[model samples]
Target: MKIFDTLNTFMLEKVKPLAFRFENQPHIVAIKNGFIVLLPFLIIGSFMMILLIPPYPEDTTSGFGQAWLALAKELSEPLWRVFQMSFNAISLFACASISFYLAKEYKITPLHTAVLSMMAFLLLCMPYQNSSADITYFGGKGLFVAIFIAFYVTELKRFILRCNLSIKMPKEIPVAVAQSFNTLIPILAVLLTIYPFALLIEHYFQASVPVVFEQFLAPVVQASDSLYTLLILTALIHLLWFFGINGALIFIQLWTPFLLVNLGENLKAFQAGEPLPFVITNGFWDFYVTHGGSGGLISLCILLVLFSKSKLCKNIGRVGIVPVCFSIAEPIIYGLPILLNPIFLVPLLLAPLVNGALAYFAHSLELVPAMVILVPWTTPAPIGAYIASGGSVSAAVLSVLLIILDALIYYPFFRLYDKICQEKEANGKEITQ
Candidate 1:
């Protein structure tokens, strides 16, 4: 009891303060919201994955599989063009979207900053060949470069404003026209600075900016898809949630680019009919570790509804069960108040780590294929896993199995907490009577 209280105090005193600071920090806030703002672009572009690749093996014995494959082959070029326009050309939107949200966070001119960010991004990352820009880096491979430009260029623009490096218009000019004119110096600065550096990299290194930067981050990128890294990140996110911090959003700010890179590499492999090179991705994290939101709260909701003796627990379970089925956790988290409650802590923290181990091994052994599609996080876990794994039944089965296991993990703790609540409620009733 003493140890638990001490640990709880430390979390409130030390961890909470740091986490709150990061949450309120403008750049961090923007990155989180920027990803939220960019979801439409990601979802629409990622849906092209379904169209570009048929979900059947080449040598499948089923007639439907064979016919589908034939149709896909016949329509390959048009499908490829559709995909090429969306997912294949994703970085263009990613850079602009993140910059726009980030500019709003800074209370600066969003349109001009977004436009400038895109120009800077294109100048550095895109490569010209045969009178057309190469589209290879525009998807997942280019995401790392896009996010960097989004942050760095936005900050650079802020720095320019801070130093008053932007052009000043005549007093008689309208403010909108004046702000538009103010973008002139930042434009030249981007041209003078970013363009020259890109030219140097091109001439000296024989590579586009994205490729060069990816090479530098190759080690970190490769390590990010490992099982150990997945478990560590999962634990971090849950731990933050345990303290009532928005751990998933906070961690997503750092983890988003890596997850997208993994997603991109997996999509590439799926389209090329090769073994998937990444087992960790946005889909994997969404469906496996966080299927019912942090701490397997959906499972808790189920247990509370079915088995709890306490009225409060039963009410929370009834209200929370539906939203959690779709992966929302707020009602359960705040209502049951999982934060700092030692009774519920272990099950909440441990279930996802357990899921990560089993899921990683299952993927490695090819019991289920690595997810190739970026299914929305809000989609039901089993269904989302099915879609994300390119329509694999086994992925859906794995999600169900994990959910059941999570329910088992939370059961004992749920009972313990319910008994306590039941006692408290009984005491209150007697006093009132």
Candidate 2:
């Protein structure tokens, strides 16, 4: 108890401030908000993917399921085109979203800046002439380049706006028209700035901006695919949560682009009926690596409800269990006070790391197919795994196994926390009596 108290004090005194700043930093905030804007596109596109690629086998014996599969196959091409228009054009959205957020940060007219940024992104990444090209560059594969172009165009717009490089209109003019007039200079400035550079690069190197970034960031991208990187990132995410920051936000900023790129490739490969290519993807994290939300907090809830001696602990668990089942851990994280409570820190941080390691090996060993589909994060475990793995019972079984492992890991710490709560309750009652 003394050690737990000391560690809690140390964390509050030393770690909290750093976590706060890291989460609140301007660029970090912009990136996080930008991803939030992209979340809808990802989710809607995932539903389209599920519609196109049902969980059951494409070839099945006579049954309703078989008929549904046939219908899905018939509709698959149109659904694929829908998915392609949205998911495959994700880079375009990234440019607009990032610029929208950054414009808010810079106090500029968001719509104009966003549109201009999207234009700049297309100008930089797309080919000039009529020719065939790999379209993946316009999707997740081009996210890093899209992000860079967004920032570049937004900063340039900020400078131009500050310089008052605009046609001043009479106050009698309609505000919307005047604002459109005001955007002219910044729009032209961003285009002039990006378009020539893109042409120069294409002229000299015969590659688009996305291609250049892909080549330059290849090593980083490769590193992101490693198991060690996954462990480190997972650990970092949980660590931030220990200090009360939204760890998922940090994870999204640093990791989601890579995860989405892998997901995009997996989707294409899966549609081609080829063996799944990437071991790690968005679904890998959502369904495999962290069961019951970040750090497997659902396991802690289960332990509390089943074994806690303290009435307070049991009640909190009862209230939190429903949400936890759907991978929403906020109730347990804050209500159970796991935020800076050192008693639960080890399990909170360790469980997710263990989950990631296990999931990584499971994939590397060919125990299950790569998760090609995206399941909503709100989807409950085991079931979510089943869907994400395209109806693989093995993946669902693995999720249940991991949940049991998480419960085991959290059991001892939960008991200790329960004992402390019981002691406090007993002491308070005695004083009252």
Candidate 3:
């Protein structure tokens, strides 16, 4: 208890403040909002991709699967194009959104800044080789570079504005017109700066901007393949939640690019009928590690409804059960008030790691294949697992097994908390009597 008390003090007094600061940082805030804005497109794209894929892995172009493949192609080909158009253009959208949001924070001309920044990004990606645009860089492969340009272009615009390089119009002119003119110099400056550098790299190094930048980010992307790294990140996420912070916002930055790259690779390999190349990905996190929402809130909610003696726990859990089935856990987090609650602290922090470790080992042993499809986070656990692993019953079974184990891990702590709550209620009743 003393150790728990000390740790709690450290978390509240030190960790909480740091988490809040990170959450409030300008760039972090922009990235978080930008990702939120991009999520609908990614979700739509993932759905379309799933539609294009045959549910059974054994289904191929020949034999009994032929008719199914033809039907799938007919239904999903056009939609697949739609998916490609959106998901492959993530870098373009990421640059625009990040610039737009960051510019908003800076009290600048957001639309103009966004456009300018996007233009800067295009300039960096210049000199397309093929008759059709070389779109490889427009996808997840180019996200790191997109982030760089978003900040660089916006900052350059800020610098230009600060230096009074932008046009200053007469006081009587319309504010809109004045603002438009004011953006001109900044836009030109961004283009001039980025275009030449891009040209120089192309001429001298014989590599595109994205190619050059990808090398720099390769290490960061490679780190996610490590189980220890994944576990640490998993732990950090629930730790933040325990302190009442939205962990997803902070950790998604670490998860998104690596997951995106792995998903892209998996999609390519799956199309070629090759085995998946990576075991860890965003899909693994979604469908395996943190299934039933962060910290196994699904298990906690079930226990609350079925076993809790407290009226408050039972009511919250009963209402929360359906949401938890779909991997939504905010109701339990706040309604049952897991955040900042000492009884929940250990289980909340430990549950994700326990789940992640078992899942990682299962994957390492090839007991379950790497998930190719990026299933929606809200999908039910077994169904999501089945789809994500591309029709693996073993994977779905693993999901159920994990839930049971998570429930076990959480049960004792919940019982203890429930007992304490019951005692408090009894004391109150005695006093009233």
Candidate 4:
């Protein structure tokens, strides 16, 4: 046991510095910086205007006729198809760029390396006319592996830098201060670049998970007709988000098959000449629309209100408001200091669970409708929430209520964050001005 312990400690000491160096290396630094610069374009181009996709009609005959409605269909169809291709291409480019930068670190030719990367990306985007299921599975897995490899290659360069480099401090500078700055800059740059891309990739691919999650939740949703079950599901989702796991992954793992089962049931009911209790009144509109799921606007509003004091945090909060309302909270989560802040840990977990519970109750009581429509997650808060719930005004109202609840939850943590910022500002003023 003593020998084992000694070896473990020895290994940790060796690995720690290597890990730190890998995170701070130059090629990694360049890729990270580039990723940050490209993130906004990638996110906006991919997610924006999704709500505009038209929904299918209730009647098959009407839908068929609408498809043939030449002038109107021609106008929208080409534009929508263009937007879809453009967004997908942009995502491919972003991932490809990361791969190229990483390849440069290995003394490999960056420009030439991109050919392989782009080929990998093309494979992901290409249509498999014969088998969509097989295509989706293989394409998604391949893309993920490719991206991971790119990151690994970049980190390897950083490792090389750490081995060959050493910093020298100026005579006038304090050794501790110089050392700290040397240690911090590279790591910060890499983090700023890679983390945001991670968030974007996770979010973009998340679209497919719900089809699975809804399936898993169906039997549970149908079992007792008890609102509590929905609350449980909502809480489970919140818990998953808290740990920094992709919330969509949790939903997909638990529910996609069940959702398929429900979908099959709905089709069977339709074939039996019975009116389905809920028809997917509009697939495009419904699938694309999303807002914080059961958590609603409350989660974002709370974060915004709490972070209002710091110039940076306030700016992030304000900028994030529109996205958060629509259920896209990546900006707020990453931009604010919430990632490591102890103060935020509580509300971040609790607020969503509470909001999810309330939403479940309201939905179960028929005060709000179930989300029968698919809509983009980037739709503004109450509006997206309202539309997803089949255009129910009550669901919009509930969304508003949840926003208020979120504000309440975020209040205390925001105060703590504000206090820290204020202290830092005061210290800066004293030192510089």
Best by TM-score: 1
For residues 360-425, could you state the per-residue lDDT of candidate 3 as single tens digits?
Answer: 899889899888777777998889888888778999999889888889999999998777777877
Cα TM-score of candidate 2? 0.92
TM-score of 3: 0.90
lDDT of 4: 0.48
Q: Report the lDDT tens digits of candidate 4 across residue range 1-433.
A: 5764564455457744554465456544444543444445433432322223333343546754456343335566564454344332443454467767666656544544454445443443333456642333221123333344346434533553467443567879986666454444334444455445444654776633323333444565465233454346546554444434344444432332233233223333433445434322222111211244323433554565555665655676777776665566666655664443455667766766666566655544667655543344456667765655545677678767766777777777777776677677767742110
User: What lDDT does candidate 1 reach at residue 210?
Assistant: 86
- Candidate 1: segments with Cα more than 4 A from true spot: 57-78, 203-206, 429-433
Q: Give the whole-model CA lDDT for all candidates, comma-separated.
A: 0.84, 0.81, 0.81, 0.48
Model 1 earns a TM-score of 0.93
Residue by residue across 1-433, what tens digits does model 1's lDDT show? 8987797789889988998898778777766776677677667766766865667778999998888888878887877776777666667777887888888888789889989998888777767768987667777888878888888778888889999887777899999999998888878877888888888887888977888988999999989988888889888898888878888777777788788888888888888889999999999988988888887787889898999889989998999999998899999888887877777789878999999999999998889999888878999999999999999999999999999999999989888888888888988752110
RMSD of each predicted structure: 2.6, 2.8, 3.2, 15.8
Runs off by more than 4 Å, candidate 3: 1-3, 57-68, 75-77, 171-173, 429-433
Cα displacement (Å) at residue 117, model 1: 1.4
Which portions of model 2 miss their true places by more than 4 Å?
1-15, 55-59, 131-135, 429-433
TM-score of each: 0.93, 0.92, 0.90, 0.43
Candidate 4: lDDT of 420? 72
